[model samples]
Target: MQTVKYFTQDELASLFKAIKKKKSKYWLRDYCIFRVAYRCALRASEVGLLTVAEYNAQRSELYCNRLKNSQNNTIRLDDETKKALEKYIRDYGIDDCLFPSQVSKPISRQTLDLLMRKYCKVAKISDKKKWHFHSLKHSVAVHLADSGLDVKELQHYLGHKNVNSTLVYFQFTTRQQDNMYKKLEQRNYLV
Candidate 1:
């Protein structure tokens, strides 16, 4: 099976920059969506259906009612994500949905996908073959794993029902694999 794809920090920054230049009315909302998804490792449906009531600023946790399964997850937000969400909430007013649609309801999964595609095009991001809305979630998992977060903890953080799902990110990247081999060679473990 092909490895899952993820966006690096540079690529995420590029996409954010492209989105900022649009001056669209929904820019703030979109920014919030992207930031929350990246930081929280949420699926598109979770991101789309996020509500203001689910965010507990004092706790810095956003509750995600998992769409794929009934088990819910409470995702911790980083300072950056908290700041962005605060700004968006202030500007948009916290009423029902965090990211309401034209009808003032939660955005649908299809609309979220379309918005992601539009931003990807605007950013001129190549390698569309591997990148998609779900890449943001993969990026979060990969980044956390690279930072030495225990695999079990990452599985819980990503709200994966099965540990096998989380194991994919633990499968080291090329650079990490090379480093591991070098260490083993230096330790004379390799014959």
Candidate 2:
């Protein structure tokens, strides 16, 4: 039973603001966790299970070993997300786990799921169940498509097994397809 939700940029920002107000370092913790999902389109379990060594600050790339998607991918980190991760690492201390327990144990996937629910509740967010932790990843892929990234480019970023999977990541209308086919037809002198 998995619920899926998409976060608009505004919604993502709102959640960040709500979580950042806390006095403890947990907010930073949650923020980095959020960025990984929102930016990389990684599954909740993949983000939670990530080890610290996977981050390459100089390259501005984040390596997420995905199980659900069954492929490991290197996600490019935008500046804002990179900064947030830097702060998280500085405050949380860089050990093995990016988000670790008090005893330095990696947080379980279930723990992150529960925490996100609590965060959503505090902010009075609705459709809360719809935006389960995995939606963050979905939002990222959708955003990439919305931003005009070509299907092949998005395919690699998402670590999808085939180009067909990338097709599902984007929303297409019949008119758009007809227009493209018409344009292709126009290119031939057979008109």
The candidate that wins on TM-score is 1
lDDT of 2 by residue, 81-167 (tens): 899998788876776888776667776667777767777766556876544787677777767777767788888888887787777
- The Cα error of candidate 2 at residue 135, in Å, is 1.0
Model 2 misplaced stretches (Cα beyond 4 Å): 1-4, 172-191
- Per-model root-mean-square deviation over C-alphas: 2.1, 3.9
lDDT of 2 at 151: 86
lDDT of 1 by residue, 114-151 (tens): 88889988888887853477888888888888877777
Off by over 4 Å in 1: 172-187
TM-score of each: 0.88, 0.81
lDDT of 2 at 35: 73
Candidate 1 overall Cα lDDT vs. reference?
Answer: 0.83
Report how far off residue 82 is in candidate 2 (Å): 1.4
What lDDT is obtained when candidate 2 is compared to the true structure? 0.74
